[model samples]
Target: MADDSIRGISRRKFIAASGTAGALALAGCTQQNTGGGGGGDDNGSGNGSGGGSLSGEVIITGSSTVFPVSNEFAELFMDEHPDVNVTVDSTGSGGGFENNFCPGDSDINGASRPITDEEVENCESNDVTPVEFQVASDALTVAVNNEADWVDSMTFDELSQIWRDDGAQMWSDVRDDWPDEELELFGPASTSGTYDWFNENVIGEDYQHTAEHEPTEEDNLIVQGIQDSQYAMGYFGYAYYSENEDSVKAVEIREEEGDDPVAPSLDAASEGTYPLARPLFIYASEAAAEREEVAAFLEFYIENSGNDTVAEIGYVPAGDDVIEENMETLEEISG
Candidate 1:
């Protein structure tokens, strides 16, 4: 994928200007570009602290919601260890686990939600033990077209009434004073963690999510669909909504009718005030973590999970305590 990292800067420039020092600090390794590719001194440190240049490939796939963070980190990590090739793909979380990750094709998988028991069983069938790491937090954002100013906040019941199958066909169906225009829905497909979370939390178990809406793994497509119509509404990760705030309006969410509506934001998510706030993660394959480059890249990722760049990319960065716990987990899994 083209480097759509922060500020539209080239990957080389981003690395030269800021990533090098940050990466070095995170990995605690000095990069020595030997004229020729040579295996680093494998001091049996398993944690990637060996001396010399690290070389190899690390493949990451999963959650479109967590893709931005993983993709950015991969670029930065690759720049620090030029001989290491890191690739991140935005396969929906379930799709990744079922196809690439559980099948042992990817070293790591990013996920917006925790893995299911079925997924764990599948991974075990392939002998891939998945190690979970919380990398960040996201406020799942429900957005509507910028021009649709009839409503700004919605209660969980109202949200359910809109998303649940055969529940609401028009805006007026949810509330009396709202517009009578037909609701144009857009959202993530069944393979997406966002879809699962939304269904379980907002739509509830009694009803099914309407299939009348457009569904895709690409969040940008949801944004585009919302942008195209005045009555369009959809939900996706907060990062996508933040990046396209001008084109769409996020709906404030109230847990119940009497509760105040909470707007989706990094602060709201971090404070646990946002109704849709959820943790984002990356699962490392235990077998792959033994590889020097994969372990090194994961170390860098965990160390920088709380960095400013995470918030800059429009999500709540992991706190110091979370990072500490994650590092311990990384060490254990890699060891």
Candidate 2:
């Protein structure tokens, strides 16, 4: 279990601050929407041209890990500019690029991992140039059932043994003194960037992840599955775990066998002590940026990427330097 001090932040405050009371209405729903309207008083907060009310649709797809951040931003942005309709879909990073982003169907795509070469080529083939922005930091979290108190930390090797194909079946198989019960595994599907990072970083490319486990794009499903069985284990972005920390126990991670384990938290991730800490990103379509609404929305997103509200959402906020660089990139791409 993670320290209560590290995992106990309230997401309710973030919802109230963003003025999106309905943010938690759906637990595992794929799509989220901010209602659309036409012509409202301009607040000059959205960085729109002429300080007039901005009206247009912005579609964001990808990254269940980064979904909370983008979804929150969309709600806040739409609150300021009621005329703009914003919809966010958690299609997984790879799925978003292959299906919506590369196809030029979405204006922006959030990602937990950097865009791949193949995805870049696919986007270029369709004449869509991707402009990347670092939005936040995530501590990819591995968790087990709250009642599974026999273990608290796992080394990379133990994690690989448990997740790799044809690997450990029982908790005792990984360690001599542990229980002999079968290990029920739940995790993100292969399409997810979270899965990709875990596969490459934890599971290693030499072996494939076990296909025998339950896989889903919804992080809530993973949490639910782990909660139902004492032997069940899973991994996901820290936000979901933070939101439901009482329902699961996070496993501290050790980079090697002898090193001290580090718990996942905004502070650890920001300080680079968490082994699984990774940068979160949102890629904007250059052509889409030409649209006044899209450009304004992107500008707003970059400017607010480092706001304290992000930490309330259970991820490390971007730094001032990163936000400044993102603003510069947005200008270069959108101007």
Best by TM-score: 2
TM-score of 1: 0.86
Provide the global lDDT of candidate 2 against the true structure. 0.79
Which residue pairs show backbone clashes in model 1?
A: none
**What do the candidate models score in CA lDDT, each in turn?**
0.79, 0.79
Which pairs clash (backbone N, Cα, C closer than 3 Å) in model 2?
A: none
Per-residue lDDT of candidate 1, residues 1-335 (tens digit)? 11223322333553343223121121212222210112222211122344439998888888988887887777766556778878777778988899899999999988989999999999999999999999889999999998888889999899999999999999999989999889999998888888888998899999998898998987878989999999999999987887778788999999998999999977788889899999999999999998878888888787666665576666777776887788788778777
Best by lDDT: 2
> What lDDT tens digits, residue by residue, belong to model 2 across residues 1-335?
11122111223443443233222211121221211111222221234443447898998888888877787777767767778887777788998899899999998988989999999999999999998999889989999999999999999999999999999999999999999999999999888998888888899989888897999887888989999999999999988887778889999999998999999887788889999999999999999998988998887777666654466667776776887788778778777
Worst 10 residues of 2 by lDDT: 29-38
